[model samples]
Target: MTTRELTTDVLIVGAGLGGVAAALAAADRGAQVILTEEYEWIGGQLTSQAVPPDEHPWVEEFGITARYRALRDGIRDVYRRRYPLIDDARRIDALNPGAGWVSKLCSEPRIAVGVLEEMLAPHRSTGRIRFLARRRPVAATAEGDRVTSVTLSSEIGEDDVTVRAGYVLDATETGELLPLAGIEYVTGFESRAETGEPSAPEVAQPANIQALSICFAVEHVDGGHTIAKPADYDFWREYMPSAWQGERMLSWTAPNPRTLELSTREFGPNPGDDALAVDADQSRNAGDSNLWIFRRIAARDLFESGFYQSDICLVNWPSIDYFLAPVLDEPRDVELEHYAAARQLSQSMLYWMQTEAPRPDGGTGFPGLRLRPDIMGSDDGLAQAPYHRESRRIRALTTITENDVSYEIRGDAGATRYDDSVGVGMYRIDLHPSTGGDTYIDVASTPFEIPLGALIPQRVTNLLAANKNIGTTHITNGCYRLHPVEWNIGEAAGHLAALCVAEGTTPHEVHADAARLAAYQAELDATGVERHWPEGRVYAY
Candidate 1:
């Protein structure tokens, strides 16, 4: 036990994708930033959670922010420069290293970490950004309507650091600072009567959130890689989810998110499909029917022959979705227990795939399936953290609801156009099975805008919602919680915080005043932030 005190212009209390983006944005604006992360890796879903980017159909084109596009390009560049790519694969400008069907830019999480680190290197060298790894937010000190400082406890040591900043950003995966700062926030499902969302439940269920999955990377090779049976393997092996349509939870048969039909996914490792021919467009094809390539992280065929023995696939399917309990708003012990249980579920799924999964050639299992712990940066083969889909959202100046983006609600009219729009994003309202024992609530949604009002909390003056913690109802979080959208939100929040510090004004003031909001938006436009989607180009899928 030692204590340290530090001060910075901007304090981002989670070095996830959003926090990293926020730190970069703030530092670019000449503000000193202190970014912290609970995990050793910086990128949240991209690295620590080992989930590939779940992007929209037009991701390679104009929908995302300039920085996000740069990050994508950086990932591609790394693969081209570092990896031993085949001549044909190296020639392609948009190179997907993994060729995973879930996203057009599916690649290894380690590559993403490299790109993110490179992006932050200039700022770090200038001493504008200070990144603290293995630090988790423990407490917050708020004076009236503003958070002055946050206390962070080191995960590895007994040392603690209290960071005081001009502006505090809540970018943690679960909105950890929201409760610590006593900010007005909402969790889980909102009642239909409250949000007026067609997909909302009749009564608000704060405990009913999306399932969190513990992802892992694996490659099928000629070896016996079967892990010891997880302690809870027997329970999970025979466990039947209520929404699974009589199929075991550990089996390949699971309900499709959209159709809710029992669909058995085909798993064939190292299928040797043309790596360059992967067209990952969810609108054109939901490519999860093939389990092996659904979230493939490394396609061996794309590299020089014999460079890799097997194509590595990241397992993050519906079969491993842990919906029994939520990690948010629970006691520490309870959260730890559920996280352990989720890991057991994932391990059991892997064990089943190696030990008893029925093969296409009438075999019992694929004994070659090997867990790649090095790929995931974990000793146990599982991801460093769980893939959390939902977060505690702040009650803000404006709340995005299903009525704003749902295709069924808007029809040909398209999503609601916000006057205070700061960024644009597009994704379907895809919700996983919840702890409330409810199945998926998939809905087609039009391309949407991230409003400046959503980033401004109703009462908090200096604290901003940087990631999935923005002012979104439970129904709208399904769309806004994706990778690109979270990045956009964080970039906007960070820039706004810096702007407020420079202009000596608050977020509410800039959002409420038309002239001020316009000026702020002009800056965003100049910096390559798309405030609105193209007219008459709204594609709902």
Candidate 2:
């Protein structure tokens, strides 16, 4: 066995949105950064997990990081330059490539990769940033409360690499570095008594983490070929839960997040409607009734007639959400089992759709739905990573609780304002079915601030949290775990690390000293990070 070693000013152990943002932020500040990812892709949720940006309505005008907006514009530019879009579609100011109702910018994961790669190209070539894909962190070297380095092994049989850095950011999906570094963290739901969240369970449910889905992409075809039956097809075919209102997990009958009532979603080839006509404001309407174009990544109608033959759609619906077991904090074998079962659940879903799904004409199945592994950069058709909704969050200097952002708690008063806000984000408290057999716990939430204190771990002097693993409680995590928010969090973490490195201080010192905190906030402001919302508040996105 051979060992490799590398050193950098900052180390980010995840190539997700946060990791990418963090790397860029640190590199921009002249700090050498090393970013690693378990998958071949760089963008986590945006590229690897295949989930589109779940953003606020005002995203186009304001209330997001400049880099994030750049990413959005880059994706739109990709469509304009590469795809032969309709004149009207191409000219629209806020042209949604896929025009999927789920997001204002529903695009293919591959396009995101291209844009991200271009963003990091300069830094990569100049040696300001070194990105290694298919590297998984296996261990961490901790000196007392600080993480000195991380030991990672190649996922593709390369030599083990040990990376030493002044600052280590846990940007990995699910906060994989927390436990490895012996960082104090919390998992699953914190009891209402602990977090004072209105919707929290009476008792702590360690195994009650939100479900993760193996998102995949598919395109409609005219052929009748269907995917091979999944090994666990029978298990999922008849699967029923006491908390669910549906007969089976595969049907259109699923519990509504807001009302918890049985609801049915219609699936079809295309609505034959204008993409501009589809209003994507989930606050006004969930916009989930139409499944085919809900999160469609490639809309053939928007392009020239012969340009595209099929409308590619990402399958990340409720039917395939796997919550039978919690993947984190479990035995290694158990975690593997949960992941395997989750993939099978998605496969079973496709099989069910192909063989037995009820069509509008009362047809049995639509075997023409062809899986597109190329879209997701996966040979097995599954997403590079599961769509994780929750993570092991650090016990930070400031923990965002349900009371801070909950509309039920704050009402017309709006979410609590933070003086040390580093960025801003908006989304509903949308918790999917969990391992504890709980149904969706979606609730309205006001636009919230991302406090810099949330990124600073309480005990770890040098380690920082840059992803969904920040100091957000289970209930609050629902709203904070979106694409833009995670990016903002990572960006903030990166800037914070750069500041600390430049000042010869720790994250704790920055938070503790009023002067340093103000300076840090000023840096964030200068970096085009939106730290607050507009005066007039209107929640629709």
Clashing residue pairs, candidate 1? Answer: none
| Model 2: colliding residue pairs | 16-44
Model 2 weakest lDDT span, ten residues long: 270-279
* Best candidate according to lDDT: 1
TM-score of 2: 0.98
Superposed model 1: Cα runs more than 4 Å off? 538-540
Evaluate residue 305 in candidate 1 and report its C-alpha lDDT on the 0 to 100 scale.
83
For candidate 2, write residues 397-459 as lDDT tens digits.
999998999888888788889888999999999999898888899888998999888998999
**Model 2, global lDDT:** 0.90
Worst 10 residues of 1 by lDDT: 532-541
Per-residue C-alpha lDDT of model 1 across residues 179-235, encoded as one tens digit per residue: 999999999999999999878889999989999999999998897988998899999
C-alpha-based local distance difference test score of model 1: 0.91
Angstrom error of the Cα, residue 33, model 1: value is 0.7
